[model samples]
Target: MSKKGDFEAVRKDIAELMHQPEYDDGSAGPVLVRLAWHSAGTFDAETDTGGSNGAGMRYEAEGGDPANAGLQHARVFLEPVKDKHSWITYADLWTLAGVVAIKEMGGPTIAWKGGRTDYVDDSKLPPRGRLPDGAKGADHLRWIFYRMGFNDQEIVALSGAHNLGRCHSDRSGFEGAWVNNPTQFSNQYFRLLLSLQWRKKTLKSGIEQFVNFDEDSETELMMLPTDIALTQDKSFRKYVELYARDKERFFEDFSRVFAKLVELGIQRDADGNITNTDNEKGGYHA
Candidate 1:
């Protein structure tokens, strides 16, 4: 095991593990990103609960939630890295895995800190249904993200991550990739959202989603109802058009928003020490 506070070493290991031939799209990057997103996405600003401070997903309370289905692949992929670096907490490792995975996958370099604790604060554990629903519309999108303190621009920027991952039918009841190159990270998701004429299609699972056929790739691309809602709402569509037109702007905004997302519910001192984290077990103190 590596020495304590060696996050750089951990980052290298996560990058190496991104290549998984047996996993979806031949990479663990997407799921790793999703794991990190779901981990911190549980934050409720009003209650000062959830967020990445506690690795609650390690238990059934968070892990068994339907919103988190299939993320075990991400945790299992990082297990070897965690074992090799025993000093790193699951909270820090999970979030860092995502930051590394995004950079390794050619996305923007996100700013991340590593003081998160794995100590499960029972009172702070987020309840089920806190995550965004793929089948929902604009109002639901606003309700879900606004609770986490995200604005319309930030909401649209975060959706840009769809460029790297596909929805699994068995897991989310939604299937297909949002972009042609599911492993590469880019503004392709925004480009496709505006360019394609997506039609609502009902799958055998009785789930309805938007689809568009790409003649070049001869493959079908998809958009969640929430994704389509981005264009339907004028407030959200402005950011969509901005991201689609300027790739650099999208990357910049996404980096800031994602960093903000992970840091939710984490109160830090001026020196960057996490004040709200439980310092007893697997926790960091300045």
Candidate 2:
């Protein structure tokens, strides 16, 4: 068999193993996406190329990022899968898990590709300040992602991820998740964003304030200053509105941009191939 055939066979095996109860703890999916985000978020256009394609967080220094506090769990969870399917790199596995989790959770179908290779040493680790602070506003949002080459529309589409996970006080010092149904993926984030009338809340130490969108009916969702700015800014709001109106459009755009995000900061092989077959079996392990 050719190398590609061997790779696909390993992918099928990994996909089958993913259905076993040993792999399902219920927490790994979202955390895996978070891990992918943290890994890729470290990229800086000026100097570092430490995005999801390298699995750079295995190094002590890279894993120490304040935003990546809980990511060790994801790395540990994938060890068995990595060991069994040694053909795929950790960087590719982690990001592919994110894509699987999003689709499994009833969200968009993320078109995935994979060409990541493992790093031989810690010297290649990226510098910090790549992930967005939950306490930041529009300017901070722009500066962080723009340096990575993302435009305003891409930023807004990416924020849809807020729909999947909650802000951990221990992890990010931000309280509550973005949506009530944090585990399930949907367009509820945008719906709540547009319908809710937000009021500012005072905070003790953070640079940003919490927003109360609709406290009484439990329809109120808190937004970080950066998340709120999406609606406040005219250009960003245009993208938001488009996403709200058309789920297909949002899914299509997100698939392209998120794939691009995961692809940054890594060297691809001459083949330029990105494999998406890490796990093809449907649903969680348990």
Per-model tally of clashing residue pairs: 0, 3
Would you estimate the TM-scores of all the predictions? 0.98, 0.81
**Clashing pairs in model 2?**
114-274, 114-275, 166-177
Q: Per-model C-alpha lDDT, please?
A: 0.92, 0.69
* Model 2 regions lying over 4 Å from their true place: 1-27, 120-124, 202-220, 267-270, 273-286
lDDT of 2 by residue, 128-228 (tens): 77788766678888999998889999999898887776666666666666677776777777877787776676556453545665556565457777788
Model 1, global lDDT: 0.92
Indicate which candidate wins on lDDT: 1
lDDT at 2, model 1: 78
